[model samples]
Target: MAQRGGPAPFPDNPFQDPAAVQPRPGPELDAYNPFESSAPPYQVPSAAPPPLPAAGMPPPQAAAQPPRKASPTEPRNYGSYGTQVPGREKAARPPQGGPRRRREPQGLAFPPQASAAAATAELLKRQEELNRKAEELDRRERELQNAALGGTATRLNNWPPLPSFCPVKPCFYQDIPVEIPADFQKTVSTMYYLWMASTIALFLNFLSSLAWFCVEPSSGSGFGLSILWALLYTPCSFVCWYRPMYKAFRSDSSFNFFVFFFVFFAQNVMYVLQAIGIPNWGFSGWILSLIALRKNTAVAVMMILVSLCFTAVAVLGIIMLKRIHSLYRRTGASFQKAQEEFAAGVFSNQAVRTAAANAAAGAATNAFRAP
Candidate 1:
């Protein structure tokens, strides 16, 4: 019997014999059989007689039965649980998210959609309003500019503002407010002329750079960059120096005066660098003009003009820097006041306080919600 294959695995299944296991039927097994007869209704054993109504009262009639529901095979629908009955309408439901009505402003009806002609008229009216606003803004701005220049609209109403020395018509710098002292006006005005001279020099250099691109194709990209730089730098240079200087004079602020002096000092250094005509500087255009001096007659003429302008800027920049230094000396700037201004600007800023308050309120709200 134990000859091979671990005694033949005990006959592969010892329980295959019918008598080895018997499945006893539970009470529910009979209930699941569809063909089985239905069981008799449950009956209770009577222990005593039921109570009777009083002798004087009549016996009660049987209660009426409710109608039967339709069978699953029937096609008729009784409707869902909340559906209205045949004889009566259902009441409307209140809106789920509470009150749905919006109050109109002042009980006025909304404006009607405009016809084509009405739309055109409305557009014209709006444009007129905008034009009026624009004119008011321009008048107010001009008045402010005049006030800053130490003149009044009333005084200048009879005559135009002071004329500028620039050759261009409608010179924008002519109306700009400069609040410098009468003694400093000549130097300041010359400084402005220097800015114009610098712009002219840059334009001349821009032209020369285009010329140089033909001579040396390697630097062709510099031509466009130079043109762009000249266009952008001219207006920016005026604002950067002139506005700061004006503020310094107008407020006589020690902090502002120091700022102007420091900034313009750096600017003077830049002027010297530009006058040197360094190759591949952002002002490479000026450098090319110098290189083309001997080869091209027209370029030589342009170079000579730009060279004179650059020299003038360098000389005038040095003079203006010195004048600004002298003005700073007279401004009564003190170290203590500068420190006070810095402290106040940092600590008393309204935006910083508002942000801090909002952060604290958010933290408090989160804390209240945590538990």
Candidate 2:
């Protein structure tokens, strides 16, 4: 009989019986288990043994090798690469894109924990050999300032390196051997001599430029500018970079160090530009000399000589710049200390205070007048 509206009409097999089919998997015959990774290696049965040793024919029996007993091994498993096995001691390897190791750090400043005793000690100990400065902090700066001025040391002006018969008096007293420390005297003296050479180079530049003017009337502008440059650069270079360097080394003044480094870098850059010799710039550079050589040989000779001097000056400037930078890194000069020194100096100066007062008052008055 067919049932309606229940599941659906089903055909039943006459030979099949639900009661006879046993579903239990006990210790008798095992079912196929795909997850049994611990299963032993599959072994194929041996072929029926070589027909009983071939009926005793003096056979190749002497060449037969003794069979080796195979070591028991669990079956190889798939889907387990880059993962920890049951007995592994090492961790899983990192991915191919992992961060590289043993990379060196560059220019990471690990500032000392004990750089300053107090905020006021910023300039003193933040520089070189700070461990010794723990004692005598108060009297040190006063003595330095006094020594800088002629209050403590009787430093007479002996600059210009001229004789008594000459009318032009010696300007500033510069005794590098006497004043500068033993460690730094050589460097400072070298710089002083370099400066003198630079002065000579500038003068030659002016003379060669004058000769250029005499040869070609069109170059009168360059000659005029050259004279101006010589006069301006000579004294200004001395005052700007050289004096600042002198003061920095003499008093261990960080502010002066900052000034020296800044001005001297620009000074070296100017040396390079002068050596390049752009037209109408009043320098005996390569371009100007080569151009003059085609017109007048005598004047070109002078210009070429001056250009060589400028080149030498530029090269020396680069060497000295590197040397100075190395000293700056190794000595008691830091940007933080320089800032502190500058702040301390500004606050102490009476003129700066007066200027500040005037500026503030003017600002206030202007603001009051604004609608």
Give the number of the best model, judged by lDDT.
2
Q: What's the TM for model 1? A: 0.47
Worst 10 residues of 1 by lDDT: 153-162
Q: Show where candidate 1 strays beyond 4 Å.
A: 1-183, 282-290, 345-371
**Residue range with the least summed lDDT across 10 consecutive positions in model 2:** 68-77
Q: Return the number of clashes found in candidate 1.
A: 0
Candidate 2 per-residue lDDT, tens place, 1-371, comes to 65676754443763364544555667655865555555355568698766455675765565674544343443554646544576764766778999767755887745465444455476655764565564456445565566777675444577878888998997787767455777888888877877888899989999998888887889888989988988998999999989888877777888898898889889889898888899899998999889988999998899888888888888988898789778878886788999999999998999999999999999999999999
Q: List the residue pairs that clash in candidate 2.
A: 128-332, 158-173
Give me the candidate number with maximum TM-score: 2
Per-model TM against the reference: 0.47, 0.55
Q: How accurate is candidate 1 locally (lDDT)?
A: 0.67
